[model samples]
Target: MADKEPEALKIRREIGLVGGVALVSGTMIGSGIFMSPQFVMAYVGSPGASLVIWALSGVVAMFAALSYTELGTVIPESGGDFIYILRIYGPCPAFFAAVTFILVVKPFSIAAMAISIAEYAMAPFYPGCQPPELAVKCTAAVMIVVVATVNILNVRLAVRVQVIFLVAKVIALTVIVIGGMVEISQSSAIIVENLNVENSFKGTHYSVSALGMGFFQGLWSYAGWYNLNHVTEELKRPEVNLPRALLIAIFLVTGLYLLVNVSYLTVMTPKELMSSNAVAVTWGNKVFGSWGWIMSVAAALSAFGSLNGTFFSGGRVCFVAAREGHMPDILSMAHVHRLTPSPALIFTTAVSLVVLIPGDFQSIVNFFSFTAWFFYAITLSGLLYLKIKKPELPRPYSVPIILPILVLIVAVFLVLAPIIDDPQIEYLYVTLFILSGAVVYVPFIHYKLCPGLLTKLTTFLQLFLEVAPAEKNL
Candidate 1:
């Protein structure tokens, strides 16, 4: 018999530690940080409480990062949480998660980022240019097309673009942080009265319940740390590098987040932060005076960097799911010359542009915040189930039992806090979208669209071991 050739894997493991960290950091530190403070201060009246909320979010994010590290190291594959869920739970739930990503979460997120990018970019040139809404929509559409072109032309080139943007953003933010700190030290800009314990917890106009709602809104800024895992298969030495990269990236971003917020708090009072829509730009004007336009340019840079990196990573989740036969086959198609998932990238960008058309930025963000956290809860539950059911699996990296338990509790709290504070009919709509995937899966699987039983079985076993409790002797 003639020798058979091994099946080709779509992923090429070219991403290294720096690239991996940039992927995570770039996605996590998006326009959320720039815009979230206003919403947060509106809820929690005190600068002190606002800082605490950001810090608490960081702690919770770190725990989730640890849990994911354990999972990524064991499976060491692409597809991220979708792969983990499909292996541990079954095809139906995995299908739903993947559907949610393609249909709602990824598209809205990318669109929102693009819109913010355009808003900041144009703010300087036009000065008071309140372009017609249609013009803004057109600009957003063009940006998406451009981003898609870059990725479709070459995957490595796309990654390089992401790295360069991220480096520039980080450097720019670092300078802002240093400049803000200098202002704090040199000027009597201290508004210590705003940090009073009683005042800190008070809401600007909303009730305590309303403050909780705002905290949920602020929490959205910190939501993208786990995005890097989606591209796990493309990462080199995923077993060791994936976990380390996540830890380092989350820690670095957390510090950056805290410093950025502190810089804002130092230069601008709580009341000022709560009132201004463009808090970062406002602070920049205060700190830099005539040179404040520089800050607006920096904000634009950060927004573009975030949009580019987030779409690049998020698009892979759809591409991989499609290749595995869980999503539409079109998403799996790669450019023959560029060696990238062109169709998927273009599809994601298209959906994002549609979202940008009718939706307000904050509304899109809130909707995504609600839906994305629901998925995170599901992802964490999958981790817990694997730990209990499969004890023998090797975990090169493991989260402490205490941390997962804590994460689960925090995840639940974060999810419910928003619902309790803001009772919305759309929340149920989001839930329905999540469940609708079950409808799509039955026909696909019945027709044997997926890999054969043995392949699935092996994948399941690997997943079970990856998330299971770490062996004592390892």
Candidate 2:
């Protein structure tokens, strides 16, 4: 195992229980809520099954969270799944994890969130007028730059902004939910014809394959439930608070999601919900008349909070990977004034900006989901490996062994469902792309065979990118 990280390499312990909750909830409650219902309903073809799929998604995520609670506190590192993989599986598999995660998964997610923010913010300004494509991308790029600047300058201020945006997100959901329930009571209109029957939305036989697809879609909406683990090193009383934050955040997000789905059902029929391009905006316009701009603002806040949290937690993945020698050592350095991993943060932001070039949010999400689930399943299975191999490792928190087993089953299904159903060649390309990381690792990292020319090039880049010496006590 590697030596303990020096205090200079450590992150500041400023995130408390509430901030931890905000990180988890705020990140998960993004554009997914506004956009995912249509896809989920399309896959399930029934209002009742759609809700069930959402609730089951929560249960699966909670199980995974419980398993991660043990790892997060016991390891208490900043890299989240990367740290766990390195500890149990060793540097090679961990190297692949870090590379795919930093290069593809996180950047794709940030771009998607930024685009969602742009769409919502632009929607309000242009009523019946389609904004130019250049304006949308420019707005999204500006949002990314602004959020990155906030994180680079002050980590604590970034988190405080996360909490504020999270509050606004909650208020928006509350308004939608309350408004839907009120409408339901006032006008007793049951929208779905065969609510729980097979193919209620479409008059066909029920298909388990379709339900699996719906599960995948719903799980994406719950994607960030484990985000707090990404910053465990920065949390106060992490051993106690990590699990608490996770449980609190997951339960809260789940409740809001179920209520929000029910609210949508109250006003819109299954066909209507499935046909909606912007579900929340459509719901708001139907319910609140011309005062529907609030929903658009709320969606913007959700995406904004998600983008900020992504930058906040995602930089640590690069930092810890650098500390372990998987990345250039310069990436491990933090700014002296803010105690933030400025180089890593800039790297994430720059990659995100580049990802915006191929700007289809659904396509990015599809590409990311397969690789993401692969790492998650591997990381969760590591718990069982560590338990059997190193039983004496002190774990401040532990879940029942069955929880990880069930989560693993669910995770495996999520990983393979899309490929089995659609047989997309792109999935093969994604797999090859992740495996391709080994090409670089075997030559440079394993054998320590970096040429002198490559070293000089990296050094030149590091000169401007990193602080010479990270602060020991900022």
Candidate 3:
């Protein structure tokens, strides 16, 4: 008689279709929708042009998500574009993807959401003036900790929290939509008069710089469309739900965003929106009177959900990279009993807290989009390469050949257009930083540098954290 072998630990497939939708749409509905409309309006210079940017941004997001469906299904793994790039392009490109995501894109994005949450949460207390910078930063850091704690505690608990906040944020947006529709129905609606054809497109900006910035800001609202891909292994049925979640989530968000923007314009003129620090609160004041603080509370909840979704997905990138030999072994481990990637999630939270100190919501979005789209273009290019070179690879879900091509074109425009219009030395530095990943990748990742130190660190962390190395789900 032989003793039964101990079962290997793996991330449970606790996320289902509804959870997937919540992760994507709830995350997409985050601080961006609450805050980005004004920035987009500022960049485009008119309600009409801003609306165009929003619609175009939605289209681009949908195309990109659909293209990701192809890759997500084919790879059937977590880690999002990092896994796709690794499979098709190789480890070097994959290493760069991991570095940017773990260091810049995900952390900057989480920081942005945290700041939004903090600003909204602290708004009611501050009254007329902007909250003190230190208070806001401290609040944001606390929020990052809370969200990280929830995620690190239990995966199922985190997903449940996501779904709850998704409902809260959706109800909040619905109130705005209903309020605006009522206003639109009234013949005396000043907002309707403002949207009259002549006024709607008034003072539209046609400059390339303006359009690029507008798209960047607008697209940030749709940033989480591919988030479910990052936790694909935790999904119950990846094939059926991956594309379905993307379609439903993205389409719903597109409609909600358009209506939400209309609602904002109905409440505030472009100048008013641009000048305002908190757009949703202002609209809520007009719509909800002294109860505008309720919107502030709602915005905080919305951003909190967005932060959790980003935290949940972003940590998996680190875990997956480590599991695939791209990162340190500690990151690839799960808590012995909890089964959550606590170490990786904590690592992500620490970086985001640092990012929150000096980075505001707007600047972070600008930088996040620059690095994000650069990797996206490469990841989608990998999809094209997979389609051509590995024709026999099983693709349970697939988009047209032209989909990734069109997305690549848009991605290239997004990466190049803004800087060409007005070159930023920051963007140049960002490029250098991205390229510099190779320096570490070659030595540490390729040559396995300093194995002894890393091994000691991994052993100590594993014991202290009560984590064991995790097995891949599939």
lDDT against the true structure, each candidate: 0.73, 0.83, 0.91
lDDT of 2 at 115: 83
Clashes in model 3: which pairs?
A: none
* lDDT of the structure predicted as candidate 1: 0.73
Output the number of the lDDT-best candidate: 3
Which lDDT value does model 2 have at 278?
72
Rank by TM-score (best first) = 3, 2, 1
Query: After superposition, which runs of candidate 1 have C-alpha atoms over 4 Å from their true positions?
Result: 1-9, 125-132, 196-212, 444-474
- Report RMSD for candidate 2: 3.6
Question: Candidate 3: TM-score?
Answer: 0.97
Q: On residues 193-254, what C-alpha lDDT tens digit does candidate 3 reach at each position? A: 55888988999988888888888899999999989889989998899999999999999999
Worst 10 residues of 3 by lDDT: 185-194
Residue 59 of candidate 3: its Cα lDDT?
96
Model 2 lDDT per residue over 139-221, tens place = 99999999999998887999999999999999999998899878877874553433535444453215645766687678878
lDDT of 2 at 427: 81
Please name the candidate that would achieve the greatest TM-score relative to the true structure: 3
Worst lDDT 10-window in candidate 1: 465-474
